[model samples]
Target: MATWSDFENAEPEMAEAGKKLLYQFGVGLAFLATVRKDGAPRLHPICPTVVNGRLYALIVDSHKRNDLRRDGRYALHTFPPVDVDDEFLVMGRAKLIEDPEVAEMVRKDQVARGMTSTNDELAFEFGIERAMHAKYPGGHGTWPPKYSIWKER
Candidate 1:
């Protein structure tokens, strides 16, 4: 859990640094998650997304999608290298969102980035729940990752 005071008083530059690092490397690593039915964790490589001031992913024809449709609960993890032996890990929950407009926006973004097929496979959005971050190499200092709680309208 995070407190408002923590994020509120954070240096603007520091927060930007952390976000840049995460966003830069968020695309490569597999997002580890668990579905509701079996409660078994799974992993999927995702293209990092920042939409409507929130983070999301356009999941296409994945079991993750099926799980999200059934239950809008999941977790994600990613590691981005900062330097030799210096890296950061992000863990968080994800919620599914289904909307035609949002789906179209995501599709356009994906196509622009050469990620998704132009077909009609788009169906869901994984909205962030709570994000936790930790840095490696011990002496790097600390600033807790920002966690976002989703409220679907």
Candidate 2:
């Protein structure tokens, strides 16, 4: 599996603007991955919000939802957009938290974004493993080794 050693050492946390950029234009681009009943990895996209280093998402009766219910193992994928056509990927593990107040807050945000109106959804916290950034546009600005991640040696 890919590890952190292969990537550049960004600070323990991203800059405030960088963090916000990941969420601003990344509403519908957040993806979740989990294991299916048969034990295969399944990936799905959903509306997501970040709070205190956790990613909260809502899905309507999705296969991924079932997978997450069966197993808390999941990941959140987000891309940070750049004006120079650059892309950054954040990879991490996730855990679902079932709290009425938290769920209600997420539901309210979802409604505001026109994503959903029900509070019957799941909330997750992702332990970010690594972040990889690369230049896009397929030109001289692109960097070598297209992408990398944080992993244990």
Candidate 3:
């Protein structure tokens, strides 16, 4: 798996496009898919944060957190665009952020951006195995969109 910075370094344009889509709402909003204990999929709306070349999600104490803890596999899909058909996605393993300093910095940045409440929660950074972006020529009506994909070497 590669860090977000590594992905960006390898595919700058693709990474930037993905980032734009992920934060298109002026905040981070995505559909996070995690593996459940039963081997089914659990989907949740999530706000993701990119800080210092890393991608993180602060998860409260919930079933989603438990799912991630039990199985780190995850796929994050960017929220649908209102006027376009552009999409971004990343698949990876989520690793708990054990360093308090890193977690605190992420929390501070999220607070400054007014993206979340001041709550201490579990933080996980994604170790990306693959990333992809799809761009349509027009809106959703367009057919056969262009796709750009990257995978960890």
Candidate 4:
């Protein structure tokens, strides 16, 4: 597994495009897909955090959180645009951030941004396995948008 910083250092363009798509709305908004306990898929809206060259998401006490805790494997897709057919995706494994300092920093940032108030959230740093982006020049008219992909070696 490669950290976001590692991926960024290796494939700066791809990583930047992915990051742009993820935060296109000036905030973290994406569709997070995780495996449920029954081997099914669960999708949820998530606001991801990118700081200090790391991708993090705070999971509250909910089914989505449980899914991530039980199975770290996940797929995150950028939120759809109203007038564009472009897409960005990332697949990775999430590991809990056990370091108190790291977690506290993230928490403080979130609070400063008015994202969260309490520290009861679980912070997980994503380890990138693959990242990709598709750009459509003519919306759905384009059969296959130009695809750019990067995989950790």
Shift of residue 150 alpha carbon in model 2, Å:
4.6
Worst 10 residues of 2 by lDDT: 1-10
- lDDT of each candidate versus the true structure: 0.50, 0.56, 0.89, 0.84
Query: Would you estimate the TM-scores of all the predictions?
Result: 0.62, 0.64, 0.96, 0.91
lDDT of 3 by residue, 119-146 (tens): 7687899899999999999887898989
- Residue 110 displacement in candidate 3 (angstroms): 1.4
Evaluate residue 119 in candidate 3 and report its C-alpha lDDT on the 0 to 100 scale.
74
- Model 3: residues with Cα > 4 Å off, grouped in runs: none
Q: Which ten contiguous residues of candidate 4 have the minimum total lDDT?
A: 109-118
What is candidate 2's CA lDDT for residue 49?
Answer: 64
Between prediction 2 and prediction 3, the one with superior TM-score is 3
Itemize residue pairs with steric clashes in candidate 4.
Answer: none
Give the winner by lDDT: 1 or 2.
2
1-153, model 2: which lDDT tens digit per residue?
Answer: 222222223443332333454566635355567778888888877676655444566655667777766676666555545444445455555556667787677677667665655555676545556555443556445545344334423
Q: How many backbone clashes does candidate 1 have?
A: 0
In candidate 2, residue 31 scores what lDDT? 59
Every model: Cα RMSD to truth = 6.2, 5.5, 0.9, 1.7
